[model samples]
Target: MEPNRTRLIGEYIVGPRIGSGSFAVVWRARHRQLGIEVAVKEIDKKLLSPKVSDNLLKEISILSTISHPNIIRFFEAIETREKIYLVLEYCDGGDLAAYIHKHGKVSEAVARHFMRQLGISIFTFWLFIFDQISSAGLQVLQEKHLIHRDLKPQNLLVSTNEVTPVLKIGDFGFARSLTPQDLADTLCGSPLYMAPEIIQNHKYDAKADLWSVGAILFQLVTGKPPFDGSNQLQLFQNILTSTELRFPPGAIEELHPDCVDLCRCLLRQNPVERITFKEFFNHRFLGELR
Candidate 1:
């Protein structure tokens, strides 16, 4: 599809297309008067169902409230008769998924740095087991009971700095709010990162986010996901029944032992057995890093 180059969105001048998804198209834009670069997400209301539109709106609303150094910043929202434009901070370094692809098996020290930062930014870190990942500015969202259902490397944006890039959690398209007692039934998120409870179609809460975090941490250290299969059916089967996680050979000896322990606790099959946020924060794995 040919993109329109002559169009101006609000006070911003659209540049090249940076990203495209089923619900929206993101463009690199420069503020007309301020001369600052920002990302503009354009969503066509006509193409989305009412439910989908509501989700998108919720994402914008959630972003509006969250302001963390490790979370994407929302500038403004512009609406038209048939479309919605969301202005957000642009991360020139792209996402963690791309970074991992380019540089396999990040050093343990680097991973610890990123994980510690993410751990601190989390708000309302405990709820029967739900712990949202990243950003001191994200507390308001947790107080409101919102959860980022899809927590993966692709959704984690990286700042431009190569030496020590700051990872900002972005893309709240699948984010949703649920009360402490409520369990989310929707089986959403990437197949590779799906928590065991999710694959079983069992009711899940924000605790599911922790499982995803574990998967991401594992992949960052090992250069691959904990589980693998030839097809979706097999993958689902493995996730549902595989209770034990097998790390790469010599991984424990090669990396910090505490790091391995944290992954095991986070990846526990039983939701009740998973590490609580309080325990996680105080654990030697992260505490020692300080």
Candidate 2:
């Protein structure tokens, strides 16, 4: 069968704009020769500052090197004087946020499926970094571990699948690579999903990402975030002062005990008290899904 062709941007046939952000626009495109569909993120260089430009380069580097089915695949990059094009694996089902908004809360089985994929993707980041440090003979100071500082429903893309929709983590603009023991002080991520440590302006490590995961999981089953307020200040205040994670009264009655336990463990205000990645991956709730 002949390939459907469209307006050519470099070697790709650019189709429709699928997404856009402050300085970039993502388009659905196809390789001219291969005819494979891909998402092309076109970034305007003129809109980027020196620091933001450096972060873009780092994002490119991370995407280029990482390989995981649950993480968005980066094919190649094409750069011109004014714009930079990132060719990526195309996800047809949009993002988790939109899916949740359309479908409302999901069943426990479905939520389990999504959480398992997310957990594995997050674990892969740590495994990839540790491998780089040990196998590449890179010095601890030079070798960096990645933290997807911005992990939320919006950042998770869904690819259509026959049996089950596949989830892939995307948007690494706020991601940072630090030494194994390093802690980040930068305040980043959506206020609702941000860890309390970050809200309090305390140095935090990868445990912060786990808190975001809990927030995502909580929303997946409850149809609303674990905490909420009228503004950012109120939101942060709620996150900081609230001692317990609560599910909606009606939602609580429908949730499994293990699922509730997992959320509570992940949402601990103290990073030290929060469940570790190993524990989270092995939690009974996720274990039962396997």
TM-score, per-candidate, Cα-based:
0.89, 0.88
Q: Give the worst 10-residue stretch by lDDT in candidate 2.
A: 133-142
In candidate 1, which residue ranges exceed 4 Å CA deviation?
A: 1-6, 121-144, 288-290
Residue pairs that clash (backbone atoms under 3 angstroms), model 2: none
Model 2 whole-model lDDT (C-alpha atoms) = 0.82
RMSD of each: 4.7, 5.6
lDDT per residue for candidate 1 within 171-286, as digits (tens), equals 88889888889989988889888888888899998778878888988998888898889999998888778858889898878878889999999899898999866566556766
Clashing residue pairs in candidate 1 are 121-135, 121-136
Point to the candidate with the largest TM-score.
Answer: 1
161-250: candidate 2 lDDT, tens digit per residue: 323588888887888787668999998899989999999999998889889999999999899999999999999998999988878988
**What is candidate 1's TM-score against the reference?**
0.89
